[model samples]
Target: MKRVEGRVALVTGAAQGIGLAVAQRLKEEGAIVVMSDLNAAALQEAARRLDADAIVQDVASEQGWIDTMRSIREAHGALHILVNNAGIEGDPSAPKDPQGAPLTDWNKIFTVNSAGVFLACKHAITLMSESGGGSIVNVSSIASLVPTPFLTAYGAAKASVQHLTQSVALHCATSGYRIRCNSVHPGQARTPMLEALFERMARQAGASVEQFTAAFVAQIPMGSLQEPEDVANLVLFLASDEARYITGQAIACDGGYVLAH
Candidate 1:
């Protein structure tokens, strides 16, 4: 039998980039994938291509979480995997100083990136518990592990996700649920979000996006931008039985950026 056969997984931010790739990977591994995002049309198109289900969601809201969980429970009858992939990089124009980030900007980052994951975990854990336990893979960033002086808000928000994953793992295990919570930190992937972020940074630096990308890649020991599939493959492993023993960990699929840097 295929690994994850008959399993039901819900991946947020499934309209594009890493979220899209993760949804495709899970479906390929025999999971009944449900892709959700704020973009109804784009998400529906993506889901059609992947042969997965689609739901509209905004992870930062409690009502959004409640509605999504109810939809999954009623439609699929069980939830096995939850990939908390929805998030934003905030504004590239924001101040770099961790403290200098305006409260508004900081709140925006936390609301979507950190609190979104927390809310997803809160709801997903309940469904997973009823389904006899499951796996949750949170998409974080390598910046959480390293200094992200240029994007302090994004960095701190992801760091919070790392800690939240750990906390959820403890709750699930201690409660005798067969659940695992882990974070996957990707570094310098050629995704739309990263492209947009770098484009903004490049503009500020008065350099071409090409130049910025080259400079960024040069810092990675792997000497290249990781494809979205590489990160999705890692999520696949973490969601599978092979990683049954792993939980409460933040794994980096950064092409060695975390270690070499």
Candidate 2:
């Protein structure tokens, strides 16, 4: 059976990795998918691959969210699912820098990672609330739960996201919005983003990618990194009616990374 058939869904940062996987999965389940990302080339490529709508948007920009929702309202009439997946690590090399994190880095990271989700929720909630409500899944990270001094800014920002998820969920539930808000915390997933991350971490540690990956994988009790589909499946489940009773919770897609560590 189709889980979310005929639903109009929107996914941000859908050009690749987890966002792309969620978009693809939703479409496969018969939802009309709309994807947004700042990268024109990658977004275009992924849109073609999924035969889904593409909107170039900067999630941190309030105006961008406004315009995006306006366009969605015009094109799709209503939005049934919203995946706030647009986020950035913004130079994970802070551990190598003796000066620590700069103010600009902190602002940029939180703006896109934390405030972006807030902005999306602010606008999308109105749309969903007026149209019988829907589900919202924020793509957070296990770093939020695990203490990562190397990823100090990212961890802090995502922790804020986790708290924000609970607040949004509770508000919507109490206000009778019928909207479900949740955060999905992914572990080290196998994606281009993971490759870039390992490359940076290896450079910082003065080790090869193979050595770095081996050490990282050994840390996870599951013995491997998570795949994009692994994260996508959980997201799809949460978005579908099967999870109608679940909200205001942070679910992990990590392959036991947070549990082991």
Regions of candidate 2 where Cα sits further than 4 Å from its true position? 92-99
Q: lDDT tens string, model 1, 1-261? A: 567889999999999999999998888889999999999999989998998889999889999999999998999999999999999987667776666888888899999999999999987887898998889999999989998878888899999999999999999999999999999999888888888888888998999999998998899998899999999999999999999999999999988998886
- Per-residue lDDT tens digits for candidate 2, residues 1-261, read 899999999999999999999999999999999999999999999999999999999999999999999999999899989999888888664542324778788888899999999999999999988878889999999989988777777888999999999999999999999999999999988888889889988987899999999999998988988889999999999999999999989999877888877
Count backbone clashes in candidate 1. 0
Q: Per-residue lDDT for 18 in model 1? A: 92
Candidate 1 runs further than 4 Å off: none
TM-score of each: 0.97, 0.97
Give the clash count for each candidate.
Answer: 0, 0
Candidate RMSDs in Å, in order, are 1.1, 1.4
